[model samples]
Target: MARGSYGRGVTSTRTDRWLRLDGTTNTRDLGGLPTVDGGTTVRGRVLRSDNLQTLSEVDVRRLVEDLRLREVVDLRSTAEVLLEGRGPLRAVPGVRHRHFTLLPERGHHTDVFAVEEADAPELPAGWAESILPRQVAEDDQEETPAVRSYLGYLAHRPENVVAALRALAGDGSPDGGGATVVHCAAGKDRTGVVVAFALAVAGVPDEEIVADYALTAEVIDDLVAKLASSPTYAEDMQRRDVASHTPRAETMRRLLELLHERHGGPRGWLTVHGFGPGEQDALRARLRDQQPG
Candidate 1:
């Protein structure tokens, strides 16, 4: 709410963990969240955000200099990246950028339009009736369209998902010392799913993961408004009511439940998808704070 300078050149306000930036609406530190084993996630290690295409110089300084960000895991499709171009962070020295889109690389799935549909107010016409009936029949109809979309990320481009996790696990970092920001458009669906899996691998509790995903709702209006002003996402944002953009906790909860039901858990899913135990441990080590003896 309050708009003041938070640090050095960062002209933004702080709303709890949310980093109020001049360009982005839903950027927050994934720190101090409780894990199942009595540990908490360490601050400055990971952050989740919406688009960074419009980040001001001050915002860039805050993320790179102040937060010591070393990596950015961009989850947007190839078309989204080509259309939007890399943002300000791309030119900054020492910050690595990796694009691991969680969508099919070809056919009907390789465009910004299809990426937008992942979080559309409703499933595209007949989508639920056609592609998702098997999941519905198998999962007792517990999957919301949003949940199904999230699961589709696993089914569609699981390698990208695992690659994103590996990037977050300090793959390119000097010693896993700097922060990594994971983001997609609006930072609600793709970013949320990836962050959820990262936190799950870090041993964060299910409720905390869901609560973190739902935090996007607090800034849903601003997020939608910001994207609506952008030419690339304007049409999609204009078509959907703002309420439809607000993420529901139950959607994330069910996603996690189904992940466990079908794949043992996030860790198991990652393992099955080729992430392996060593990589999972590295990711866990990168995300979790050391518990006191």
Candidate 2:
């Protein structure tokens, strides 16, 4: 667990992949991912992370000075932020913070699972029971936990989800900026979906997207423990085993397909949701780097 070392088990050649912040294990740069057009994602432009509430003084300096972070797209619900208050980064002058609740207030904690329980009647008895704070009587159907959770994101709050991307693509920060950090409480579920879409739009292939999504798995145990330690996520943790909460690559894979089949892929979905030609071009320019010769 050296600084910049992303734990022991996982391996990658992504040179700037993990940020190694003292407060969070899940922070990573969405850079150096291979795009379909033979280019790579621009290094230091987009970073994703869990909560920043505990970022050490050194961590804040690294983000501001080292990473040149300018915009922070916070995807947590109003309740989550109000409960946690502003993290250290909130008061910083150089960084611009934007709050876009990816989930409606009603669906903040239990309501997300409530929607999942209703739509996913096929979960195994024990898992379905564990779906919410209370047990859900199971039916004989099957869906992975990651897929179910993603579906809940789409089902519950698709509008804010699209808006979050649009904000990341634009340059309307307190300071005009491109280096944006997208994050939620854990930076796994809601942040994963939004970042997945951003990468897809940048022409990063499906496999790479899945790899980035699955990277969260490496730190799942520690993330769960961190969440469980807080009252904000304690009840959510009590709902299931930590293993069930770990992310799987296939979860993102299936979600990509769902976007393709249902919303006509990333470009079409964004277009339909009002990310017009101007915004699209701006986003690509902001994220895409020239192909290394």
Candidate closest to the true structure, highest lDDT: 1
Alpha-carbon lDDT, every model: 0.75, 0.71
1-293: candidate 2 lDDT, tens digit per residue: 00111133332326468889889979998878877777777778888999888899999998888778877888876556656666898778878777776553432333221242344223232321322331212420255656666766665567777777877776622223647899998898899999988887777777777788888888899898888887777888879998788887778877777677777776777788777656766666668842211
Off by over 4 Å in 2: 1-15, 107-145, 172-178, 290-293
lDDT (Cα, tens digit) per residue for candidate 1, span 1-293: 11111123221123667887898988998877767777777778889999999999999999889999988888886656655765899889798787787765443434332344354233233221222222334554456778877887887778888888888888533238688999999898999999988888778767777778887888888889998887678888888899888899789878877777778878778888898877777887787643211
Please give me the total number of clashing residue pairs in predicted model 1.
0
Error of 1 at 46 (Å): 0.9
Please list the residue runs of candidate 1 whose C-alpha ends up more than 4 Å from where it truly belongs after superposition.
Answer: 1-15, 107-142, 172-175, 290-293
The alpha-carbon deviation from the true structure for residue 80 of candidate 2, after best TM-score superposition, in angstroms, is 0.5
* Model 2, residue pairs in steric clash: 122-141, 129-136
